[model samples]
Target: MKWLLQLVLTLSVTFCFTTAQNPEAAGRASSWIGGAEHEGALRALKWLEEAQDLGDGGGGWGSDAPRALLALQLSNCSWIPNAGMKAELAATKLELQIALLLWRHHEPPISPGRLAQYTLALGAMCKDPRDFHGHDLISLLLRHEPESDFEFAFVTLAVCNSGSHARKRHIRRLLDVTGDTDKHSADTLAMVVLALRCVAQEHRHRDLLRFVAPPALALAALQQADGSFGNLHTTALAMQALEGAGAIAWDRGAAMNLVLSSQAPDGSFGDTFTTTEVVLALQSRGLAQVSQCKCNKPRLPPSDTELGNFTFS
Candidate 1:
């Protein structure tokens, strides 16, 4: 009877652990749209789609392909008018741009941030970052000595998302950096939490949770009376990071209220970049889940008038 009880207890623990780790089980649907917050997210999605530059030799928004792609993927806006074709075309152009950049610089094809961004963007687009134009972007990102804490955190996220092993040294460095509360800003701490969370989820390393705790705490501490971490972009990032780390103590409701309050009449949070981050945060999407987003609904074709006048610029 004692042995049977222990077996049942162990199974219960296992089920709880699995459920906590699984995003779907945790009620984090990739493309959930209905509530006020979700409606705001949809508005931001439309703003981003319309903001895409469809002019000659242009297929990106805000001159940043990876960020734009990440935002689009998070929203799963393929069913929104002509967003599907726009995303595909933008992704292709971004891929070609990456290839050209690699061709030009053999010594070090791209900066760590740029390479990380590209890896993330490709992953979101369902493209393999490892074999992009015969260049191994993940390996290249690992080789660089990241110039800043932000760069290091970005690289770690990219590596983890690409299904590649994050180096222990990099993880250790990030842990060390995150411990110094005086030096890092809210954005940096938020990024560190996100990167560590990605590594923890991918490797199932429960040990990393302790290391992730300090940064997550610091990020929560940065929350102001209005629930913003100084600004819209950082607040949005913090919301996603804290949630991703499972830092359940933070006041998510207040933070979300602050975010929702900032949406413009056009559904954007100021610029393309800010709107992108806000949309992701509003949806509870972490970088790791960006590539996992899938739209199961049958795509509706855009009207001829919509396609013919798609150019925003």
Candidate 2:
């Protein structure tokens, strides 16, 4: 209990937030353009917090526990568990989640992609995947063979966040099997760009980063005229990559519109999973950009996109 909630306030208050210089950067972006849209974002966040498994963090896998954890990290959602949920969430809730994941990992085995994503959720909140309970996230991923473009992207991001060198070989294997061409989906391209950027930062492999430019271009080309990658789930992830890299100028309006439009009157997305992702994507718009998801790492070098400039180690 004390172990978990102690860091809640510190973590909640420290996340980055920044306003877009131009509110008009995109048409509907104007909603989030004003920082969480005040009422709307909070409504969405409130819905997410309520969706938590109050007594234990094992509500569901998709966005129930880990995904919601990530969403809370990305947005300024109120992490103060409700009077009842707070005490519960701050105590055995985390432990319950760890135990469940470990149990699953041993039996059927958590999918490589889900493991990578779970690692990300933990790392985003400043938790260590190296020693979560008795499991090592990197060790888990090392044994996995990624089956999709998204899996590669998630694994790359997980490694970057943990700063683990042992998994580099595995990541390279995934990359070698993947393509950075137009054939990839926007979601896939975005993940590739993000994973490559993480590689450049963690390993200083600028050579790998150079290959990211094509996928970035491919992602830009995939955008619908409306400013979303066709749906809130994909668009939210794609926007994170584009905004984080500061590459491939995007239709801010479209991106913003997608987030704002996806929100229901209840202040939530269609469900717990999409709501979690949607909130993070919209929330990021108003937050100061970070150099990388690695908690502490050198910035990325200037991208060819010429939108946002950063430096990498």
lDDT of all predictions, in order shown? 0.70, 0.59
* Number of backbone collisions per candidate: 0, 10
Show where candidate 1 strays beyond 4 Å. Answer: 1-30, 53-62, 77-84, 106-109, 294-313
Candidate 1 structure quality by residue, lDDT tens digits, 1-313: 3533454455455434433431211112345634777888878877777677544444447466678777776665343223434445556556656665775654655678888888887776666787764567887887887878988898898887777767667777787866686689998898888888777676555667778888888788888988888789889888888876764578878888889989999898988888888887876455757545453312223335323432211
Clashes of 1: 0
lDDT per residue (tens digit) for residues 222-287 in model 2: 888888886788888787677756566778677876688778887788888787766666664311
The worst-scoring run of ten residues by lDDT in candidate 1 lies at 19-28
TM-score for candidate 2, please give it: 0.70
> Stretches of candidate 2 above 4 Å error?
1-40, 53-63, 76-91, 104-106, 166-180, 285-313
Give residue 313's error in model 2 in angstroms: 18
Shift in Å, residue 218, candidate 2:
0.2
